[model samples]
Target: MKILLRPVGLTFFFLATHLLQSQASAPGGSNLLFYGVAALALIIFFFIVVSVADNFMVIESKQMGIKDSSTMGLFPNIREFFRGKKPGYLDTAHVYTLTKGYDIPMAGAPQDVIREPNVTRFAVTPPDYFGLRPIPKMLVEEGDVVKAGDPLFFDKNMPRIKFVAPVSGEVIGINRGLKRSISEVVILADKEQVSRTYTLPGREASREELVEFLLESGVWPAIRQRPYNRVADPDIEPRDIFVSTFDTAPLAPDLKLALRGRMDVFQAGIDVLRRLTPGLVYLGLDGRGEKDSPYSVTRGVEKRYFRGAHPAGNVGTQIHHIHPCGRGENTVWTLGVEDVLLFGELFQNGRFDTSRLVALSGDSFSEPCYVRTYAGANIGELIAGENVREHSRIISGDVLSGTKKSTDNYLSYFDNQITAIEEGDHAEVFGWLIPNSAKASVSPTVPVLSNDLHLTTRTNGEKRAFVVNNDYEQVLPMDIYMTQLMKSIIVNDLESMEGLGIYELVPEDVALCEFACVSKQPLQQLLRQGHDTMIAQG
Candidate 1:
């Protein structure tokens, strides 16, 4: 229709102009009424032809799976024209500048200096990974000496995915929790550390071979899939893979500091990840950093820049904006920056090197700094002699989403930071009624005098009515309606939950919302429940 209209419209238009010209040139004066009517008809016909052509082009582009960015109708797309543009510092990378989300300012950010902590104990906990069946089958007994990369256990449901030791050591203890479920597989590190090596895959190795290598070597658990936030399935291919190069949670370790002098290894890791997925591997970089950030130069992945407060650095946020995982079979894998480095080290040295930079941070520590330690290093040893307060609460990971740990416990398997904060056991006189300026808050009721506020374990208020307000929306940068979604989860409305975009979320993604919630609702736990319900229903 468009092709047919173009030529016919042009011929009629030219003929009309000629007739008008010929009439005006005749001996009789030009017919003013006829000329006016003819001009109006020509203008209307021209617009109709263009509108029809535009619609046809849009339809054809949709049929061919091409995105049409041009203006539709007779005018421009005002919304796109007024939409926020990418910051000048993003360079050529795709940019997602989020305006929502809050940054919880607190004291005890880790210093840049990296110290060698005398960490002699490390453990691999099975509970860290979601969707794992209770009590994974053990591969080693206590008192067995093993090298790094030696398999310690495997999920009984998926026995191929092995959990390996972080250091060459003696299996000192196989700790158990309630119902005799395996909690921690503790290993006492040796003075002389050794690692087990395996044959590297060939240059032309297939994706299945790479998956098998990762599974067998125990690095596959680092690659987690969305929709359940569990370890990526070995049999299923992800639509895409995502890695956030920076951490934005409160007191989170600076990944740039961790990325220093490891660009080659990181690139190697990217190469390995690329082969596993037929889709592109996406790298999310901090938009506030320099143009020459090592992550920006990384090849074999799609680079995207994110600038915002807390959740912007989250890979879930990046995935939601870039390519969200839909319901059902749609899945996307996500890995932390250190996880990628692990893969790089595996391929580079043909062994699993669990060496990581752990940040010791919080107000309780006398000197908060970065420490070089193995994965699952003892939290007590990591923070030994750093305590300044008489009573402090130790947490493995960032203050927001980290697990509470004690001096006797080891670090969480996936965490790279240990935080120590004051234990808020003492009760305050009318604490809720009295607005303390020293306390940090997202609400306007409390006056926050400074950026850094000393936080504690105390929930300022008890659970109240789940009020429908912008509080959760203020901190959650994603498009999903957090309040309604939580309500859906509470009511167990599976259809409504799915429609509210529950698949795109993980607990950490909503940690900020939980912090900002005026009702003091446990949003992360609720989201986890929603995920479990969806998985069970499927």
Candidate 2:
């Protein structure tokens, strides 16, 4: 009907205009006013009819699960382009071009070459995880001999989820922290590592069987749910599962190197994850670097290409764009690329292989490159003989959002990169007044000659008043008002936090915002407090 009406409307409009022109040319213009009024009325009626027909078409297309590309109007696709609404599930991949973000250009990105590090000591720290009890029930005692994948400890609250050892080793030490809280379970890895094997689930296995397998095999901790960024509950099925195939953090490892020769294992992992959720498994890919990459050809998942600066590779940011988590009872599971490989190893080899490629990067080291090691490897052994700068800070992950650690500390369970940068404790004379080209600044006052900058552990400025401005919004790519959300979280306003889309965020999502803030407010810490408050309320 819309197609037929187009020609009829055009015909009436032209006829009325021609009649009006003829009447005006006639002497005294007797019927000029009548023709003019008729032409004006016809124009208005034609637009109204077309608009109604367009609405009907849009509604019909939506009902039929079809994209609304056709309309009897001036511009059909302009509205959609401005709205930036793209379907998460489609035959072809969806591209998300995020413009609101800042990529910190830091020196010391790892080389493509992978090296085997001599990391013998490994430890499983319960405090590394969020919401876990400070004193978890220990499954192994000191001097106990256990194989890789053996249960080290279990949270008293969630006894089903077991935290396992990364390698065959003996329990060397069980260290405690403030208030005698269990800090680290140190292990001395044996030369010949052995693994505990289990029966692989069948292809026709039920969801319960798969969940039970994951829980018992100690791989459940890899799957963390948002809204609190804690371990996923075994009983409640998530609405969707998300995985980011790349990392965009400063001095972060190239994930393509990690995925090398592990394509089959990665696919098997994706297959296992598909059974855990009824919704689509979303894979966020790097739009700038995924061309000809192995992850591009990955099957059985919805691929979303993200292009932008830092935090573009963050899974939380991707989740916000694709399918945001709602305030209450909307759970979304997220995992890293390495976590998926562990799942594949469990199903294929019948053992939880925690082997991963850790990138040793930053300007502190003489030669930065990739290191092949297991999870929770000792920081000292990983970079034992490397030439490192004096008075340097060692971080268990990337500089941004990574935990600070000493040489004696072990890597975080979820970290795949270790960063070392110079400490910024020394005082600088006239540093605030002088503009140094060597320093990298988001502000135009300090000249940044190149994107690759040599940064230190310096805040540059101290915390002062929390001014209301667009500084956070300039770096945060999501739709949430970052400044307002931070303020709400500060006052412990639960109602305002939920309404501001706090459920859709984790600490890493706002790490860039914290970095870009002129006030230097600890946004990540503040966000964690908000999460704790929300969890306590329930």
- Compose the digit string of candidate 1's lDDT tens values, residues 1-538: 3344456667877876777777777777357548656785977677697767777765564445332323323344444556555456554555666768887778888889888879899999889989987799998999999999999988888988888998999999999999999999999999888989788898799888878888888788898888778988888888888999988989989888878889999989999999988898989888865454568889878887777788999999988877789754578899988899999998986778888899888888878898998899988888775755768888898877889998899888789988888988898998878767888778877778877788888877889999889987778888899999999999999999999999999999999888888899998899999998998998
Question: How do the predictions measure up, each by TM-score?
Answer: 0.84, 0.85
Q: Which residue ranges in model 1 land beyond 4 Å of their true spot?
A: 1-88
After superposition, candidate 2 runs with Cα above 4 Å error: 1-92, 327-329
TM-score of 2: 0.85
Candidate 1, pairs of clashing residues = none
Clashes per candidate (backbone, < 3 Å): 0, 0
- Model 1 lDDT-worst window of ten: 65-74
Model 1 residue 359 distance off true place after TM-score fit, in angstroms: 0.9
